[model samples]
Target: MDKMEIVEKHKLLSEKIADADMVLVGVGEEFNEDFSDIGRFPHLMSALEEVDIDQMLEWTVPFLEHRFLIEHNDGRLVEAYRNLYEMVRNKNYFVITTCIDENIKKAAFDTERLVEPCGNHEMLQCSDKCCDELYPSGEFSDLVKQAILDGVGLDSLEIPKCPVCGKPLAYNNILCEQNYVEEGYQRQWKKYTKWLQLTLNKKICILELGVELNLPNIIRWPFEKVAFYNQKASFFRINASSYQMTEELSDKGISIGMNAVDYLREYQHL
Candidate 1:
């Protein structure tokens, strides 16, 4: 959708949801991969061991997991999470995050006590020809400050060492990898589940933005059901290509085809 339309939609949605007591906003993964403003980084190709690069593209988790690992290790994940947390907290919105590593979420919350499980060995192992650029970790400022105290130039400063093992560090933000492990991730996930279940019955508007039906079961099916029984509820799916509303959903839901950010911006102006 164009900017104007998006803003208008968001304003309407926000107003519509204002009285609903609780609004469950499910943040999708990497909404637009091609958007450079979002930034791209190296991802570990775990499937390279068993399948070709062409075949690996069919599997979403491995590719995304790799990118998440790189982004988290570099501190981008922390910044994004902080931004999201602040936004939600300011609005007094009871936010729940799904499909994100628990430890990464914790680090984002704690801020000062950031830690990564894998050392540089994992990074070197995952580095491939296609993956060259490093995700900018916002933590670089702190590293630079430390380097200045030691009287070193930016170019001569070494990469930050891992606090856990005192070894060289790499981004440990990959999600859904077989080897991708995080402490306390499950605990946060359980909390999210509890919150979702507890908030299910109230009047809600399922604002499904840029989501596709064929993508993953975690998003599609549950949302479909949520929009089913909630009599005062509505489901709005905004997408460029896949735009359709079931007979039942159409009776109570509103589906649009457009860019989500543009819609939100338009609504803000309205």
Candidate 2:
């Protein structure tokens, strides 16, 4: 869009925030700029494809390492969250994201006001989720690094097994949803629910960035429901393609078709 149009949208969003008692931001899959993709890690994908059996960690261990190795201090993900924080910093706001990366924390967002229910890459849990415990994910990453330095294949190393069930260990994310443990983010979920309750009948601003159908129940559907029910709420949806608001909410929210990252970056810079 043109500069004047961009400025107009920014002005509208600012007005909504300014008039609200509570502000909520929902970040979805697009926020995960570092997430593994064939375009970004073709070798990893090829490795997984060549394996006969489930050689997931062959891909996963390296995946975690790749995510951790990135210096977020100057990365786009950190910059996006930082730009977003500046707009909502002064408002009574809470941020929720499906991304498991630690960039939000790196952006210095208030821990008490942010939640990531999809799980984090830095933590591990039993593949079967035999217990509520989550282990540090660094152990497997270290093993992968050592093997790389030793010029040996990962097959030569023993993957960490779950202590409770003797099953394989996995990242604490939805990929292991067969029996994913929720303890890591359950408390924060409760806090988020309580915060939502407080928004009822109050002036609120809801901004959803790059959200999609990946977990509609958690964000998309609920956000639309809240916006429709709360007459005092103003909503904005930004995405490259899936920015359409529900017909019921079209009058109440603004849906802009654009890349969320680009929009945030430009919005901040301009």
Candidate 3:
């Protein structure tokens, strides 16, 4: 699309955002740029395929922790997240994301207003399920940072141990075969469920940002259902590449093939 078309879509989206009583933000990996190269699933698996399954498991856990904690910094919080914070700060809104990054939190979004089903990198859990407890990752993150400062690699750092069971601790992110602690996720899900029921007939807008069809069953399809069933609701898609809505939502949906950050930043001034 041309510049004018992009601007027009933003205007229309802004209008819908302003008119809605509540905004439901569905986010994906595209929201953060720092780990864009690391990739997900098959791509990540290909990179680690050389290592045996057992060795890969040993390397993958801490590798992910270092990626989010050591490599990523607050500087990566782009203008789009900031502008989005401004747009929804005073307004009634909730965010649902599949990413484990802390970009949204760093941007000043309320913790109580977010639901992260995929977990986060700032926490850790016992590997043996010794207890249903999660430990803060600040100390571990600091250790990793210190190791990097000393020009040492992740392998040089000692793996953290669970204080209760004395076993190795693992990052609290959801893994393919590993069981994950879901207390925090369940709490957030309860809050989201309550809000969803309360706003069933209200004027709601689903702002799908950088979310593709990767895991449509989780947030994408559900958000589409709500927008489709609610006569007064609308779905606005902001993606830099593929931007589309189903036929049922063609009339109520607005698709803009523009960078999410750029669109939100432009909408901030408008």
Best by lDDT: 2
Q: Identify the leading candidate in terms of TM-score.
A: 2
lDDT of 3 by residue, 20-107 (tens): 9998998875765455534443333443442344462464445444554444444434567777887677668999988776667767
Candidate 2 TM-score, C-alpha based: 0.83
User: Model-by-model lDDT, in order?
Assistant: 0.45, 0.77, 0.73
Tens digits of per-residue lDDT for model 2 on 19-51?
A: 889999999878875543333544444434434
Clashes of 1: 18
Name the runs in model 2 displaced over 4 angstroms. Answer: 1-3, 35-72, 139-157
Q: Model 1 TM-score?
A: 0.51
Error of 1 at 257 (Å): 1.0
Candidate 1 lDDT over 29-73, as tens digits, reads: 333233232243312233232235344334333333434443444
Better of 1 and 2 by lDDT: 2
